[model samples]
Target: MKKLAVIAATGLSAGPAFAATGPFFSLRNTDFIVLVSFLAFVGVLLYFKVPSRIGALLDSRAAGIRRDLDEAKRLREEAQEIYASYERRQREVAGQADQIVANAKREAEAQAAKAKADLKSSIERRLKAAEDQIASAEADAVRAVRDRAVQAAIAAASSLLAQQVGAGQRSAGIDEAIDDVARRLN
Candidate 1:
């Protein structure tokens, strides 16, 4: 009914203005033949259900487009998930790397401390050894000096006694002094 009203309005509005050469309904008129042909073409399209088929085709195309859009959206979401997973892995790797670095630092510090302790011990041992050697040398030097002094005193006393005493007394005193010196040395 709406189509009929639109057609009627179109006919009434364009009829007189365009059909200027002759009677608008006459078979000889070009405008009338053209209008009839156009109407016949429209009627054939309607009779064959072409408009419905076209609508169906358009609906199927739209559905295909919607499916494509949905697939694209799903793919985008999957990509985002993959990206997030990679980011999480990256963060984990970074954390592991940090942990490794921390461990290495701790190990290095421990080794350094151990080395320092070893070095200190080594130095202390060397110092103790050096002190022992020095003490030994000093003892040897003091003993040598004491021995030299005792020998000098014995020589001086023997010389003085030889000069001061008579031969017989000197000999007897020397025997007694020798016995006393042997006893004292022991």
Candidate 2:
């Protein structure tokens, strides 16, 4: 409106019909008519649809820009959400790994304790078995020595009986042998 008023004022002031005509202006009315006609043509074109076509094109461009902005915002939000979810999953995995490690450590400790106990029991059993074997061996050795001693005593007694008893002195030598056996037994 202000630009239109300026154009109107300039047109009215430059007209010879409103004031004195200048020497450089011969067809002032013609210039004024041409100016009004041009302004009318421009106004008619704008009023009809030429400006509206250009405005609709600009409005569609603006809408496209807004859509692009909204899409970018939504995509950015989705990326952020994905990053957050990934970080959460990573933390959970780390926690689970730590739990597994702790459980493994505990299990290993339990297994170690069980193995130590088994080893100790096994050693005790082996020691007991060794002791039993040693006792048996000692008893066998004592028995064998006693058997050898008994055999040696019998051999000596037989040799003495054979020596002391001549061909005719058997009864007296037998009596002596009995006395010697009694003393040896005591």
Candidate 3:
């Protein structure tokens, strides 16, 4: 109603003579037709509230975009945190692996040293046993030689005694032995 009042005021201000002189709907009256069409378009736009609806649509779209951007930012931060956690875990696992390797190396070295010591002890025992066997063999050889020497000395002495005592001497010694026995009896 206000727009109608404004249009009416405009027409009135143009003067009654201007309306009377022009053909209202003629092709020759371009300016008047153009003015009417422009006013109708403006009226339709106002009746539908097209500009405010467009403003509301744009505001909602902007809010949705803002929310989406915030969500993207939050997801990015979460991803970064997860990545950092994984990196830290990886470093810890690497350290543990290194320590495990070091421990294994130490254990291996200790085992090797123990083996070396055992080998040395075994060699020493074997060497000592061999030496004892050699010494026992040497003692046995010495005893055998001494026994042979004693047998040889006894055989030589028996030969010497047999040669020194003749049959006549043996008889005289036997007669002396008999007289000595008779005296003992008396």
- Candidate 2 vs candidate 3: the TM-score winner is 2
Question: How do the candidates rank by TM-score, highest first?
Answer: 2, 1, 3
Which portions of model 1 show Cα errors greater than 4 Å?
Answer: 1-16, 27-30, 40-53, 137-186
Give the alpha-carbon lDDT of every model: 0.90, 0.85, 0.82
Query: Evaluated with lDDT, which candidate comes out highest?
Result: 1
lDDT of 1 by residue, 62-109 (tens): 999999999999999999999999999999999999999999999999
Residue pairs clashing, model 3: none
Give the RMSD in angstroms, all C-alphas superposed, for model 1.
6.2
Ranking by lDDT: 1, 2, 3
Per model, state how many residue pairs clash: 0, 0, 0
- Give the C-alpha lDDT of model 3: 0.82
Candidate 3 runs further than 4 Å off? 1-46, 133-186
Task: State each model's C-alpha RMSD to the native.
Answer: 6.2, 8.2, 13.4
Query: Best by TM-score, which number?
Result: 2
**What TM-score does model 2 achieve against the real structure?**
0.61
